[model samples]
Target: MSQNWKFFKESVRHFWQVGSLVQSSRYLVDSLLADVDFAESRLIVEFGAGNGCVTRELLRRMRPDARLFSFELSQVFHEEISSIAARDPRLTAVHGCAMLAAQMFAAQSVDCVVSGLPMGNFGKCAKLGVLSTVHAVLKPGGHFSQFQYSLLDYRLMKRHFPAVRLGYTPLNFPPAFVYNCVSA
Candidate 1:
């Protein structure tokens, strides 16, 4: 399909940032959102919207009034997400870095932050900056769900979040570990 092609091409071009050559499997997306209460979460932020697979799923599940700000650094992926945002009033596709989340939104304004970023590929400063920004925007008790090919940034996440729960999904392109961390 066209989706697969775009994902593959983009991944090949930006492997370190995009992470995978295929879009996330439905199983992986479900596992990442399993603990999130979409109905109760009014404001959501998605880091590394990539090809918009997870963004579409979040739009489908979130409440009518819920708002989704999907941040994508890649131009191709950002355009893809922007097109989807054009059709969905609730989605705000942002072409920027995840580390700037705090600048884009008010502190304690987000109910949750979901990410498909390749944290393992990020340098320590980038990892910490993004995590801290995510934490700053999230409301108390808000959740941050991120999936990675490995537990590369597990310790970093634990340092920023008060509680971090880990899970795994074997049905993805490459099986992934999902971290569900809650802001204190």
Candidate 2:
């Protein structure tokens, strides 16, 4: 009962600040996968997989040998992810900060990184730390994709990646811009 309340409140709090917005038609789970090519990836990592929305899609598209590691902070959301994590050997639910990604994953090990984290909520230091860690874990040609409410960081993505591609999903409530980045 208390757990449910915690989930509800946390969802509400972060939703307004950063949670999945149905009005914007943005459900972190599904939208993130619309453009992914699962055949090109075997080891996938997800940053800030809230409510396993995109997580589930990754699992669904994965090859039989594929593995998924998702990082989530909220205990409530963590628990939600764990519910499915335990059922699938391919899914590893990591309860920790996104900044620790490189430590948790082997160097140059990930093929694709899909983040649901709201960079808008974090400071510049945090964005750099987390993105650096992402660069550390990504293979030389690995891709990084993240969505934001605005186009404030296309240049930042360019600095971090060799190439950056932009796409928009107006279906999401308030609309969203997806940044598709790859290591140079």
Clash count for each candidate, listed in order shown: 0, 9
Model 2, span 48-109: residue lDDT tens: 87767677778988988999999998777789789989888899999888777888888999
Candidate 2: where are CA atoms >4 Å away? 1-8, 14-31
Compose the digit string of candidate 1's lDDT tens values, residues 1-184.
5999989998999888887889999999998898788879999999999999899999999999999999999999999999999999999999988888899888899999999888888888888788888878999999899998887878877888789899899999899999999899
Worst 10 residues of 2 by lDDT: 20-29
In model 2, state the lDDT of residue 66. Answer: 91
Query: Per-prediction TM-score, please?
Result: 0.96, 0.87
Off by over 4 Å in 1: none
Scored against the true structure, residue 105 in model 1 reaches a CA lDDT of 89
Which window of ten consecutive residues has the lowest lDDT sum in model 1? 151-160
